[model samples]
Target: MKIRTIVFLTLFTCGSLALLVGSWLQVIPFTLTEDLGFITGALSVWLTVVENIWNFPIGIANDIFFFVLFWQAGLFADMGLQVLYVLLGLQGWYLWLHGGKNKTSLRVSNISPLELLVLVLITGIATTSLTFYLQTLQDSAPFWDALTTVLSLVAQYMLNKKFVENWYGWILADLIYIPLYIYERLYLTGVVYVTFLVMCLFGIRAWLQSRRAYA
Candidate 1:
């Protein structure tokens, strides 16, 4: 196996173990009523740090933790999105390896004005519809949860296609997510978003560099 793949697996195992132990000890709270635990929470935060930096492998880890945290917090939209994240992760990993012209490595691409408009329109519509469902059924922070879910769909899809604008979606989502995660008492995830907020800045810069280099 590749060295990066091994490392990714190691980190994923460690992170999962940490979460399991933390949950057992009540260190990682899975539900809204539960408070955060230290070790498991920290593991999750670190996983996000890894994911933000080198996403292909780390993305697998993220989908795992995200499923647990969002489910616990009643953020069903995002929780369900985690399943999509995993599927998209595989598609993204393959594309990154062999989706360029003539099956070359993938390079970052630009988002045209029309594409941006479509993404915005879709996200807005999805967010609005989901907000109503969440408000009525889950009584959760409907708008914020729905917002994250919708934007994540756009961001994840864009990233899979190697679009530089993907980071912008993450930055926006992370800003709203910090507060929303904390409100749900998924404090570790809240911290993770803060980390994502910072790393997304770096990601945008890196991808822009790739754009020039690959162009």
Candidate 2:
């Protein structure tokens, strides 16, 4: 890592820790777990935008925190999604290290049109089924929750495969998530999603540059 990158990560981590402490002390209106999740989630996304492999471990931590937080909030689909994220995070870690041609480091690539069509169909069907299941459980925001959950899974898969289109999926998911989290009264988490939305734009630009470099 470069010196500037180390300095930035250190500063960001410290600032996040301060927010977590403030939440714990009741100085902030957010829960401790939500704050922790926000910190790890934000860092993970930022690192991902920079194409860093370290995002996987940090994202796994975010997934654990969010699982507990979502469970308490009665977002069953999201809680389940976190579990899948941990598994995906592990796979993404390895792929980022050696999933390219000849087992080299992964490079950003575009998703094929057929793959895009298949993913869209899968997302639609999965969201419908999950929404129905959540409705049976009286889940709040069932349709939106199910939609974001499936979108997130698709985005994570694209990310693991180093597809540049992953940012589009994340951007769509985050747009829905910002309002959904606020409705659930997880204001801090909503804010985190807003941040994720912005970082995803940067991810798109950075990954495109990377792809051009590879070419």
Q: After superposition, how far is residue 61 of candidate 1 from its true place, in Å?
A: 2.8
For each candidate, give its TM-score against the true structure: 0.75, 0.95
lDDT of each: 0.72, 0.94
The digit string of per-residue lDDT tens for model 2 on 1-215 reads 78978998799879888997898789989888988898899999988989889999999999999999999999999999999999999999999999998999999999999999999999999999999999999998899999999999999999999999999999999999998999899999999999899889989999999999998
Full-model lDDT, candidate 1: 0.72
Worst 10 residues of 1 by lDDT: 32-41
Best by lDDT: 2
Please name the candidate that would achieve the greatest TM-score relative to the true structure. Answer: 2
